[model samples]
Target: MRLPIITFGMALAFCAVHLFVGRLRWLDRTPRSRWLSFAGGVAVGYVFLHILPELGAHASTFEDATGLDAPLAEGLVYTLSLVGLALFYGLERALALSRGERMAREGRDRPHHPVFWLHIAASALLVALIAYLLNHREDPSAAGLALYFAAMVLHFVTADFGTRADHPEIYDARGRWVLAAATLGGWALGLLVELPELAIGCLFAFVGGGIVLLVLKEELPEDRKSFFLPFLGGALLYAALVLGETYLAAA
Candidate 1:
């Protein structure tokens, strides 16, 4: 009973971040906020420390469900991870090219309506998967759930900033709503339907890959002028927390 209540609260929190992210004007800046960079670092740390390791641990379960050869079954999750990363990378590149072309033609740097919708659809799907996973976590401990929630909330801040930057007017008007709805809808679906372990593993792997690409894209772009020290601090802090949690669980 308490777990459902807590999960529902987390779901609402996820939706709130998307719906209200535009109001955070401080995050809009030329040189990117150190805090956003720090958020990205924590997100990356969670992917590396938690998500990826869990995917590996689920490899055998995936193998049993799929009944593929050992090698293929073991590799499939990582392959899906790469596919997710590449898919988002391709989307980002497409948006960049479209924005450049639009800038050259109309003196506007944003994607057209079609491209914007396409991007939003993809983003919403990712958000939905994230929300769904919140209800289907491998480790449902209070500490684990809290860590996951904190990392994702911070990640969503960075993600919302990027989306809002890309299409400010449209995102505020419609994109946020779409994502917020997706978050809640995903949670509702999770409450009603439980997927197989293999399916959950696949979802986690794909999301992990997407997160890595999204976080790195923001940090690695020189034009953003991202802060390094804050990023490092965030990564180290999150890594310590995760390690401590693991140690305690083991004990």
Candidate 2:
């Protein structure tokens, strides 16, 4: 009962981030906000320091549940992570091409209407999956949940900014509401359905890969003029927190 309530609270919080991100005018800048870069760095830290390691730890559990050959099972989660990264990379490339074509043909710089919806739908799915995982985390402790929530809140902030930039005309009008609803829907789904540990591991792996790709994509673009110092500060701060949590747990 307590866990569900906590998870629900987290889900609402996640939804709020999407719904209210537009109010963060500081993030609306020609050169990307240093804070957004910092958010990206925190997300990257979470993925590399926590999510990937958890996937590795769960590999054996995945094998035990599925009874696959040890070698195959061991490599499978990592492979799925790669697949997740590739999937998002491909999506970004497609969006970029659409934007370029539309700009050249119509003198507008956004994806086709259909492509814009597709991008929003995909983004909604990603947010939903993250919300679902809030209930089924590897570390369900208060500290663990706090770490996950902080990283994700920041990640969503960065994501919302990027998405809005891509489809400025439609994003504020419709896309944010879609993402917010997806977050709550995911939490409700989590309450109703308990997936197997193996399935959970796979989902986590895929999301981890996607996070890595998404964060890097936003930060690495030359035109964005991302701030390196804030990014580094964010990464280091998150890494230290994660390490401290690990040490306390082990002790």
Clashing pairs in 2: none
CA error at residue 155 for candidate 1, angstroms: 0.7
- Put down candidate 2 lDDT per residue, 1-251, tens digits, no spaces: 22888889889889888888888999899777889989988998988888778888879887899898878887998898899889888888888999999999999898888887887887887899899888777785789889999999999999888888888778888899999999999888888898888888888788678888888898998998999999999999999999999899989
| Model 1: CA > 4 A from native | none
lDDT of each: 0.86, 0.87
Q: After superposition, how far is residue 215 of candidate 1 from its true place, in Å?
A: 1.2
**Please, what is the TM-score per model?**
0.96, 0.95
Cα error, residue 157 of model 1, in Å, equals: 0.5
CA displacement after TM-score superposition, residue 224 of candidate 1 (Å)? 1.0
- What TM-score, to 2 decimals, does candidate 1 have? 0.96
Model 2 stretches with alpha carbons more than 4 Å out: none
lDDT of 1 at 34: 88
